[model samples]
Target chain A: MAEFYSLRVNGVDREVVDAQLGESLLFVLRERLGLLGTKGACEQGECGSCSVLVDGELVCACLVLAAAQSGRDIVSIEGIAPAGVSTDVQQAFVDAGAVQCGFCTPGLVMAAHSLLERIVDPTDTEIREELSGNICRCTGYGRLVEAVANVAKTRIALGGNRG
Target chain B: MTVSVPTSVAEAVSLLAAAPDSLVLAGGTDLMVEVNAGHRSLDRVIAVDRIEELRDWSISADRRSLTIGSGVPYSLVMDGPIAELVPALAQASRTVGSPQIRHVGTIGGNLGTCSPAGDTLPVLAALDAQIHLRSVSGGRTVSFSHFMTGVKRNSRQPDELITGVTLPVLPGWQGYSKVGVRNAMVIATASSCLAVDESTRSVRVALGSVGPVIIRCTDAEDWVVGQIDWERRAVDDGVVAEFGQRCGVAARPIDDHRSTAAYRRRAIEVLSARQLRRAFPNG
Candidate 1:
């Protein structure tokens, strides 16, 4: 018998079906929900390519079971920016040219969003530490660091305090 | 085909006792990794992350003991007042995977996994921490040393879940060091944790990844404790060399892809001496 679970994705209630016993949330989102923004790379949790926010906590989607996420709120990278509009972090990534191959961009952006949510004005060291789980083969992380730092500076200039 | 998310400790205990085969899930860091790698099979998972009762934490009335929730995240340990309580644990927590891993990984997860290379295992062993287990039957506490028996094996039964961990509010300096292939997001090739109790003038050291289970250097600990009066003698070239050799003898490493037994043996000496020196700066 197939099991179904209710999940809140991007503030919208959705019924996820055919959540097999061992199917990962990454597979369900990409295969079922068609949320391809959450890439599946290194299916092992080593690379943060499948990062997502489950109940406001960033976790490797590849490591989370779809069944385990029942009744939980999940935010994927696609939900962060809506209708051709990019978030400040995403904009910073573009301005800093942090995207190269772009395979790691979604995960990096999700991780950066999680970091910025907790820390409004993060230092260079803090940003690096927060995104250490994310592995990017291309661009060597310099622009990514600059991207997060740029958002931090912008938030501070806008009179926002670091959480 | 039962999935239970108990809101309280009592509820969780009751559910666990009802289904002894139920797999307890907290943080799901290690379990998820194994499941993803096809190393684990699970049909019944009991999520304990939301049970507020097990997440309770408090300092003992005497201020000499601290009881921390088993579900407390390592990131919390690295951030707040809890870090001050156990600096070695905080340092070890920093070595766990990375920020996201620490943010989600719980100390209970580390204890439940019972891996020798677990960043917090050696520190818990050096601190002589206690594991608090609870079931529908009742509650029982065991020493960390006795709780862990082998690699990834523990005395905890399927019907029981870890409630919390308790350790004496240490009254001295504690240090932890890990030698891994990389500084970030890497497992330890060999790790050592050393704690110096000035109140009792005792020193305890535990080594990880060099044995089937985390091993303590009783001889070196005793030697350092005995030489407290002779601080200069304790740090002497001969004493350091002897301590290192004894630590190496205590390890029983195996040749794996991460490293060879020979390399791990040598690393035990170097890391043990370094941690000991850091803990006993005067020596």
Candidate 2:
């Protein structure tokens, strides 16, 4: 049975009708709401290509059920920056050449965004651990690590609120 | 199809009683994988992670033990006081999946999954933790050894749910370690936990992923007592090697997708010795 679900996604209350019972949040975001920024590669939560923020907690969106997210807040990569603009983390990724195929860029950006939100000035070990779930096979981890580190340094200098 | 997200343990029990065939979802780390793969279609599901009572945990009376709710995530167990109470469990939690997985996976779910390789089981066995079970009829507790019957198998009845696990607070040294293809987010190819009880001058060692159930090495444990000097609180390098060798021999490892039987046997032997020495290192 399909039902209507109203979820506060990306700072907006979006109504989704015809919601299937076992539909994943990744599917709802991409297919239902048309928020295609959150990519879906491996639906089994192995690849973090579908990473997103559920009430400020970073998780694999593919692993979460849309129905279970009744009143929760979800922030996808599409809402990470202002309209027609890129956030520092996203910009840093392009500057550092961390976007190879670009399929994993959204997930990496979202994960880094959430990490900076919580830790502010994170160490290399902390940054690596936070982004462990998100895999970028083509880009390799070095560039992504550098991009996140670059953003972290600037965010710290900016009083750590910029991400 | 109906998915029940109960706010309390009582509500969850009632929901299950009404639908005995309902699948229990915790963390959804393991279950959702199968669901996404189209291996099994679930018509009825009960999400237990949301129930607050299922996540409740606290120190036991007399301060000699700790009671952990079934829904307590691995991250909490790693950061909270529970980690300090059982260092082996904390060590195991740190190695389970990645940060995202740890944020949701619970010890109770590990028990519910009952995978022989699930990292938490060996620690629970080493600690001799008590499995708390609940049903619409009543509640009961069982030892970890008795709770696990076989690989992905347990004595849990269809109508029963795991409420929590209670483990003793060991004042002595204890630790856990595993051998995986990679360190960050790989399942244990072979794992071992060692706990030293100074009061009895005894040690408990358990191996996982190398048998149908986590193997408790009584033979190795007995030798550990004889080998370690109570007064010196130390054991020779040879004694440690022999102890690990004995424990490894007791495991019934088989060739699996992750590793071969011969390799798992050797890995357990090396891991057991390494964890034992780390817990009771010579200064």
Candidate 3:
């Protein structure tokens, strides 16, 4: 059974037509909406390559049903930046050389943004725990952790709303 | 395939009664995996995640128990007042997948699945929690021991929805421990939770991934209670090793892909002993 539905992704309502009930939010975001930035690896929730923010809470998009998330506010990698500008967290990733294959960067960015939004100055343990879902097969966790911590310190110095 | 989103418990139950075969979708942490893996088919789905009634939690009038809504995610249990009330549950919550999974994964989802390896089941079993279920026909509460029937199976009827769980606020230390291949985002090879009740002067020990369902070690619990000095809140060093041995012997694990049966039994023993020692540090 295929039905039509609309999702508010990145503050815009996108219509999905004739989607199967089994279609996940990750599938719809990439294939239907042409939002290829949200990668889909290991379609199961284990990889965290499809991590996205649903209603401002981080979740693996692959685990969410597209139809069920119709009315929720979804923020993907494409929406993370403000008008084509990279946020401090994204810049920190570049400065720290956290990108290797660049496949897990979008999801990692989403996870980092979600963490910094809730905790302005998170500890190293907190950063590791929060980013645990987004696995960097490149094994760039040392620099990834550093990037997030640096951004956290920068956020505190800037005094709020910098994420 | 139709996805029905109900706003309240009444509507959800009515929808379930109308379509008993309707698959209930909460967090989709477990269900979507099966669907993605081509293990389960989805047609009519009743999405209850948005229902406000299922997301709210409250304390009893007497403050003797806390009733957490089935839809309350593990993140809520990992901190704040609920964590203060049930530290074992908080510890278990922290061990669940990661922050992303914890933000959406609910304790109700764990109960609804009833997998033998579910991280939260052992803690719920040790606490002697009561599961609340509702249907268009009526409502009833089942004890944790009776609720889980077998691996990935429960006593819940097709039309009945799990509403919440009520756990007593025991006046004692409680802790949870598990052994997995990795520290984070890894499923437990064997997990154990030990809760000590000062008022009853009794101990409750539960193990996961070591039996058909969450196993409560009645023999170990009774034996350990006798070894402990209730007044001094201590236990003899000689008795702790034997307690661990008893818990290991009680496990009914099998050789699975995740681990060997013998290793799971041994892990349960080690986890149980460590949890007991943590609960009674003076000993």
* Among all candidates shown, the one with the greatest TM-score: 3
All candidates: DockQ: 0.57, 0.64, 0.82
Model 1 per-residue lDDT tens digits across residues B38-84: 88877788888887766667889998888888888888888677778
Model 3 CAPRI rating: high
lDDT of each residue in B242-261, candidate 3, tens digit only:
89999999899999899999
Candidate closest to the true structure, highest lDDT: 3
lDDT of 2 at A98: 92
**Collision count for each candidate, in order:** 0, 0, 0
- Order of candidate numbers by TM-score, starting with the best: 3, 2, 1
lDDT of 1 by residue, A1-163 (tens): 4777777777787787876666678888898788899998877677898889988888888877677666788999988878598888888899999999999999999999899889887888888888888999998999999999988898888887432
lDDT of 3 by residue, A121-161 (tens): 88898999899998898956999999999998888887875
Angstrom error of the Cα, residue B239, model 1: value is 2.8
Ranking according to DockQ, highest score first: 3, 2, 1
- State the weakest 10-residue window (summed lDDT) of model 3 chain A: A154-163
**How far does residue A79 in candidate 1 sit from its true spot (Å)?**
1.6
The C-alpha lDDT values of all candidates are 0.84, 0.87, 0.91
Q: How do the candidates rank by lDDT, highest first?
A: 3, 2, 1
Name the 10 consecutive residues with the lowest summed lDDT in model 3 chain B.
B229-238
Model 1: residues with Cα > 4 Å off, grouped in runs = A161-163, B229-234
Could you tell me which 10 consecutive residues in candidate 2 chain B have the lowest summed lDDT?
A: B274-283
